[model samples]
Target: MDAGAAVLTALCGAESFSAAMATRPWARSPHFFVHYVPVENHQTVLTSPAHTALSTKLSTELPTDSSLESLGVQKLGMVVPKRHARRAVTRVLLRRQIRAAMAQHRCELLPGIWVVRLRAPVDRQAFVSASSESLRIAVKAEVATLLGDVLRRCRSTRHAAQAHAQPAFQQPSTVLSAP
Candidate 1:
């Protein structure tokens, strides 16, 4: 897959971050949870120069269309709380795993702002070291599952919204001719 196609904006700024947090979460597991909110206009929400650079790069690689324009760009944010992973190394490792797993499912995800927040710590007894390969593998699996659930939920929600937006029935027009 093209790097540009897989690239995702990292959500910044307090307003956008808070907005993502306020949205209902799509999935949750022992270690992490996901929150996402659809963005109607990427330009308005993504004001940073980095976002512009990424958008231009993506646009050049992909064909332009109304759907593509409306889809715009997808943004991601990660929150590895210290309470969940006390060691900085562990937090960094988890963050990297989250990014990689999300990248794999980028195509399935709708254009929106998504945030993955760490909720619990991995048991130390399971893996002796923070850098243990086993721990990395476990983290990757968990992240993949979390993202998969979120994507499923997103699709269902979108379908529901579309169903509601369509008119149930149309009224027939009545005409009277001169008697």
Candidate 2:
């Protein structure tokens, strides 16, 4: 793994993907689905179960090393199901592409658990060889597109939040708080 990917913790254990976390996908590409959810603050992880007991369970069930939930960095995981890729070589190729793509966009992504799941298979006839250069390039391009969209969405959401947080037509803080 490269330095960029080394910094990223990989999500493992079934509990990490349980209902408590990443219940829904945040974005999608032609053959992939991206799921991003902020890991709950450790101090308050079990304080409130937003919907059910699963929230409390999440903390204990998740494996320690693989899940860097409390840290302010991206934790990644990929699901290239056998059903989708079929061949071991194809699955491995897809996984490498996903990791490379994530490493490329890690700096821009929000600190959270990010999963890239293979939802559909590529057209086998189009690229007969399982792990051809064309296939790798195609997967890389699709993943790049997926991450790009996620970045845009995160930026827009952040902007909207900043806009909401500031009061309209407010005097400068220096003047307003003058002694």
Which candidate wins on TM-score?
A: 2
lDDT score, candidate 1, position 25 = 75
lDDT of each: 0.74, 0.72
Model 1, which residues run further than 4 Å from truth?
Answer: 1-7, 41-71, 161-179
Tens digits of lDDT, candidate 1, 21-76: 77777899888878877766444444434445536465545433232454546778
Total clashes in model 1, counting residue pairs 3 or more apart in sequence or in different chains: 0
Instruction: Evaluate model 2: give its lDDT.
Output: 0.72
Q: Write the per-residue lDDT of candidate 2 for residues 1-179, one digit (tens) a residue.
A: 23454356676556555532445778888899887766454213223344345454565464334344446667788888888888899999999888988887777677667878898976788879999999988988888888889989878876787889987886666646658
**TM-scores for the candidates:** 0.69, 0.73
